[model samples]
Target chain A: MSAHLTEIIVFSVLFLLVSGMGFVAAKWRAPTDMAHLDEWGLGGRSFGGWITWFLVGGDLYTAYTFVAVPALIFGAGAAGFFAVPYTVVIYPLFFLILVRLWSVSHRHGFVTPADFVRTRYDSPTLALLIAITGIVATMPYIALQLIGIEAVLKTMGVTGDSAIARHLPIIIAFAILAAYTYQSGLRAPALIAFVKDTLIYIVIIVAVIYLPYKLGGWGAIFEAADKKFQASPAPGDGIILNANNQVQYFTLALGSALALFLYPHSITGVLASRNRDVIKRNMSALPAYSFLLGLIALLGYMAIAAGVKPLPGAKPGSVDSNTVVPLLFDLHFPPWFAGVAFAAIGIGALVPAAIMSIAAANLFTRNIYKEYLRKDATPAQEAGVAKITSLVVKIGAVAFIVFLDPQFSIDLQLIGGVIILQTGPSVILGLYGRWLHRGALIAGWAAGMGLAFWMLWQIPNAATGRKHFGGSAFALSEFGFDTPKTIYVGFVAVLVNLAVAVLVTFLLRALKTPEGVDGTAKDDYFADEGDPRIARRLPGTVEKVSST
Target chain B: MAEPESPHADTKPRTDSSPWNWLLLVPIVVPLLTPLFNHDEPRLAGFPLFYWLQFAFILLGVVTTTLVYRMTRSRGRS
Candidate 1:
């Protein structure tokens, strides 16, 4: 069979497998009622440790990550390795943050982070802002996953060079994804993640072992990458880091770490766990992906060893690095192995895209629809709204890819990171204590968002010839700091967010502004699975509580 | 359905934390040092420090995950 035909068959099989799993997931735990948001959105809030591990791992380590990291190394050299450290740091940091979020969300029966913000800080406006930010940030990330799949399609020669012809397959794939995700809610991805992660681990393990021997060796790869980097005119292009990129490196890494857990989909994954211990266990274990990421990053070097050249006038080094893995497999492995690797990347896209749509849909259903449109909406109605919203979200991401310059998708992804970071004060800080006033949180999100946009406007990318409108993550020097030390714009923006929150809280208090009623008790933050006060109950049932 | 008990709910907080808890730092520290010890001079399998260091990290990851499971589990329950 032709390569394109083989790829199509592999993709078709994977699609059927995921859809079959989605149908089966409805019975995974056999929740009492699929109509309720809790059962559909949070998977009955009863996932055990192993299930939670695989689900969260599959959610966080995505196709965009798998494609982009190695592609980045192939394109830019050492800077691509930023993904490895960022992934490593995120888990340990989450160990500290997520346990608290799980406790607080469970206590309040919260599905989205914005729900926590609304009650904890007593501000509907702030909750709305957070919900909007999450939807906006997530859309581009979902679009970027399409980019990963497109890279594979291009390598398999399934896509013609014509713009319209190239993206038709992706559009169809996403349409199918939108349908299943909308039908099944988070359960679709949670079930599909099992297959996606298994394929990724198997392909990467075999590639790491088999590729070096097939090509010359690790030595041959490194030598070629070094030669390529040394010859490039860009300062710090080939093998190692240079002075100019260090600040960008540190800030990008740290910014990504802080922003990692802040994504609504990330919290959605964390909240689905049965208890705090699941979050804790996953945090300590998820860094295992970093080891895999390190191997994946080396594929860029492997591409260099194989003398894989970028397409003509493609900025010399910039021919879609996302294609490197697919290309590597095509060059070295037999057609069957290549088909499997392509399937791995294809399935990787579905897991996160499903989760992102579900998370975004939940944000809209809980924070927007129920909060404003229909406060008396039934559980079935809420699930219906979330299902429709997920379809709209997937369609919107597809439109983003179809309409805009592909590079804009990357910038938008970074902007999403900065935008979601605005929620740190409300979500992360609120978990520990509710000291900051809700109004202050709103003002802080505004100021931080404004500053992040202004800083992003200053970065310029030379390759795209896109000036003053490039990367969204900012370097500290732009803020007039003299030291070599640079922090993520999100980190800086979040600092401003916290400062405004704290300062405004004091001012509001001094003015005798009402702090508003807290709907939860202080002890609820420490409640666990069997806490009779906080346990999940049948829909439409109510439990009496002793007034504190 | 029966009420599922929280595993750590009744357990007392660790009064004397093990030094082993610090082993969590190994994955983070080792990866960072791999670049520094890389010496910019490439070698393979003889003193292939880069590859060896990364392999060591995989081992470190296995050890840390096992340790975390042991530390978090109940003394008698497991």
Candidate 2:
């Protein structure tokens, strides 16, 4: 059979497997009622530590991550490794931030960070901005996952000469995702994550073990990568970092660390855990994926060693770098093994896309819909809103992939990181103290967002021959900072955000402007698993398990 | 001073040496340590040593997850 046929058959089987898992997920630990937001959106908020660990791990380490990180390393050289350290740092930082968030969220029954922002700062406007930012940030992320699926399709030779024809499979896949996600709510992805993560593990392990022997050894891979980098005109374009990219490196790593936990989906995973300890335990453990990521990053070097070239007729240096892992497998491994690796990437997309859509949907429902559209909406109504909103989010993400350049979608992902980073002061900082004036926090968010956009506008993609700044991250020098030092624009934007917030807070306090009342008690921040006041139990009004 | 309430009080009562209580640390620590032992090797089927380490970690991950589940159930019974 032709390679295209082989790929189609393989992808069809995998798609069935994922969709079957999604349908089956509603029955796995099946919550009795699907009408309530807690049940539909938060998986009833009773997942044990292990479940939450897998769920969050699967949620954060996505198909885009699986494809993009390596693809980046393949294309840009050492800079791609930035994702590794950033992921590593995220867990430790979250250990402190998440536990507090869990306690406070549990006390107030918040499903989204915007909900907490609303109550803590007593500002609907701030909450609204957060909700919009979350949706905007997440939309591109969901679109990026489609890029992973599209990469597979292209490798499989499932495309037309035109862009629309090339992306038809992605559109169909997302349509299915939208349907299932809407039906099952968060439970769909939470359950599917198990299958997705299991597949990814199987594929990565087999490839890592099998690929090295075929290509000679690690020394050879690094040598090839180094030779490639040295040959390139770009100063820093090879196997290791140079002086110019160091500031960009450190700032990107730190910026990403801050940005990772700030995503609404990340917070959703944390809140779904059974207690604070689950959050604590997952924080230290999730770094394992970072280690896995480090391994994945090395795939770039492996591609170089294997002498894997982009497909014929591909643009100069514009070959689908995302296909490197799959191409590596096809070039060296048995066909069956290639099938499994393809399945892993395909499933990886589903897990995070599901979570991103759910998180975005929750933001719209709790922060926007219930807050504005229907204040007296019943729990069932709220859940229905969330379900429909998830559908919209999935469809919107699909549209982004189908309509816009895939590279632009990646730019949006970086932009999403920048936008979400604005929430750090509101979510992360607010956890420690309420000293930040809500008004100032709003002002900071605007300033940071503006600067982030301006920085993003300056970055130009060299490969596509596009001139405008196109990716999610930016270098400090790009902003015309006179200092020779480089920084991630998100990092700089966040600093500006914090500075503006601090300045505004002091001004508000001096002027004796009314700070809104905090709905949560101070003791709530320290509440743990056994706190009687916040103990887990059936709500007083629930008359039956199947009420929905 | 009053003894702090047992954090696991909301669930089944805890017993001394309950495996579930300790299972918590496995996911937390295993991922953190796996990298220290990770080393580079030649590519097999286009994958490297660091890549294989991820697979090894995944195996370790599965074992840890199973152990945690079993411990939780056993502790609940005890």
lDDT scores for all predictions?
Answer: 0.74, 0.74
- C-alpha RMSD between model 2 and the true structure: 6.5
Predicted complex 1: CAPRI docking category: incorrect
Candidate 2, residues B1-78: lDDT per residue as tens digits? 012233233533222234453554443344334234234345554434444544454455445544554554455344
Task: Show how many residue pairs clash in every candidate, following the order shown.
Answer: 1, 15
TM-score of the second chain in each model? 0.50, 0.50
Per-residue lDDT of model 1, residues A387-474, tens digit only: 8998899889888877777643445667788888888888888877778888888888899998887777787776677777677535
Task: Return the TM-score for each candidate structure.
Answer: 0.89, 0.86
Off by over 4 Å in 1: A1-3, A161-163, A311-318, A408-410, A473-477, A480-487, A539-548, B1-78
Q: Residue A34 of candidate 1: its Cα lDDT?
A: 80
Give the number of the best model, judged by DockQ.
1
* Residue A384 in candidate 1, Cα distance off native in Å: 0.8
Candidate 1's TM-score reads 0.89
Report the Cα RMSD per candidate. 4.6, 6.5
